[model samples]
Target: MGILKHYSGGLTREQFLFYEIRLVASLICENNSRDEIYNRIMQENLFQYPTERMIRSMTNICFKRIDSLASQMLMEHLANASTAVAKQINLYAIMRENGIVYDFMTDVIGEKMRTQQMDFSHKDINSFFDTLQEYYPAAADWSESTRAKLRQVLTRFLVECEYLDNVRSQALKPVFLFPELEEGIRQLSDETALCAFNCFC
Candidate 1:
């Protein structure tokens, strides 16, 4: 596991593809400076609802994850694919990049799935958060409101990505990466692709 970074509180708390953010990130060129990208995105009105500050955070989150070929393909699917499932994968990537807390949560979920257990409870999540706090002091200081929101995000993540039937239910749904996409992921980074497969599917 990687060293957990302090949780930044800007992650959107709903299922969002951020199509506008994707449009903005697609404009990034190899030589574009930070100011250049920001100016261009503003001029184009790529994101308007969340205020400029939130837009910038969202943009940074999506932009950083697009370096690898697998990530690039995932972005393409997220941006252009019509299916909800494809967009779900895209959202997963967004959460993976932006939600530092989710990495730990997903690891626990993956382990449970391996044992043919598909149910989860608040105590299960809280226990993971407790363990997470050992490595991330910030987790220990979260307010009740923040902790509640994080729990909501976790359930929403599973539901939106088709991993769970619903937020209130625990039965896990089967998810499989398409062969072509899986091949692209492997070609780009075998280790990452394997981890993705185990964690999600």
Candidate 2:
């Protein structure tokens, strides 16, 4: 919910790596040091990402998203919650870690929901990016592929988190936050970000 000072294309690298995120959260819950976690992931191919380079890249992305949360309770929920709840928590973590996604959710997606506008399209995504470039001129430097992938990733994330029925439908779906997850978010004093989850708190 804080002001976005910059935009990042990190989401393009991975779109809601739910299993990988849960693994990282479980490792963190086990009190594994960062290096220990990274090494274990590298050695065991925990992410099953096909190659060393991919495994390393995914490990770094997972850590970047998970570490910024800095909430043991949230991590525990992500590691142990039921699938629906865990996915919601993972989406929350992503919004916290990625400003571009956070704004897209609250400003574009949330606004659409508020106006009862259910149609989501590539045009909407492009307009959002156009506005972002205006605010952060450096975002204009991203390659076209990067922008395309980001659009794909964000749409896929919305589907994964149940904010949309599916990519093809692109219809807004109501997201009712589990009480425990809502409480966990509140504990972080970031209840404002709950708008991204359709909580509108």
Candidate 3:
């Protein structure tokens, strides 16, 4: 079952918006310590996020993502890249590394792709969640409303990352890795490379 007993991310769609990607990229480019970067984001009055907690969450997530990729050189490559898509892909990788839900979500996508199931549907998402609940009893307690929202937000994230054609539409779109991105991935440890490849693929 792909269900999480105690899902850890709990991030809203708003927290994963395009601007946040830009914000993360900027932070990575600055290459400051986590506390220094957090202070810079908070004091510079740049993002205008909802609360201090959300800002902290974003900062933590970004740092965790950088760590998961397991290479400061790759982080530098990503920070220097020209396309927003590269940064989004990196963020998506981080999300996969840091969030149980994201790992399951992408695994489902990869499975469907391998099976040549090109079009995804809401029913598939429901089934995936249903399967999760079977293994994670706690998942059974999640409200239908909450499940629906998560499904919507996850789909939106895929669309933003060019993994899907659109929300509510399961058309899988492959993102071609930039040359620098590819090089960086190759430089990572075998385990980290495999994990990053799963997200990139």
67-121, model 1: which lDDT tens digit per residue? 4233656656655565564545554455355545345434666566556576777
Q: Rank the candidates by lDDT, best first.
A: 2, 3, 1
Model 3, C-alpha of 168: deviation from truth (Å): 3.6
Scored by lDDT, the top model is: 2
lDDT of 3 by residue, 38-131 (tens): 8888887566877888788777766656666666666665566665546554654555454444555455765664565667778777787787
Between the candidate structures 2 and 3, which one is better when assessed by TM-score?
Answer: 2
RMSD of each: 4.1, 1.9, 4.4
Question: Local distance difference test, per candidate?
Answer: 0.58, 0.81, 0.60
Worst 10 residues of 3 by lDDT: 189-198
Tens digits of lDDT, candidate 2, 29-117: 89999899889998987777678888878878778777767688888988998999998888877887888887888888878776778
Worst 10 residues of 1 by lDDT: 190-199
How many collisions per candidate? 0, 0, 2
Off by over 4 Å in 1: 1-17, 25-41, 67-71, 95-102, 188-201
In the predicted model 1, the residue pairs found to clash are none
Please state the error at residue 166 of candidate 1 in Å: 3.0
| Per-residue error (Å), model 2, residue 94 | 1.1
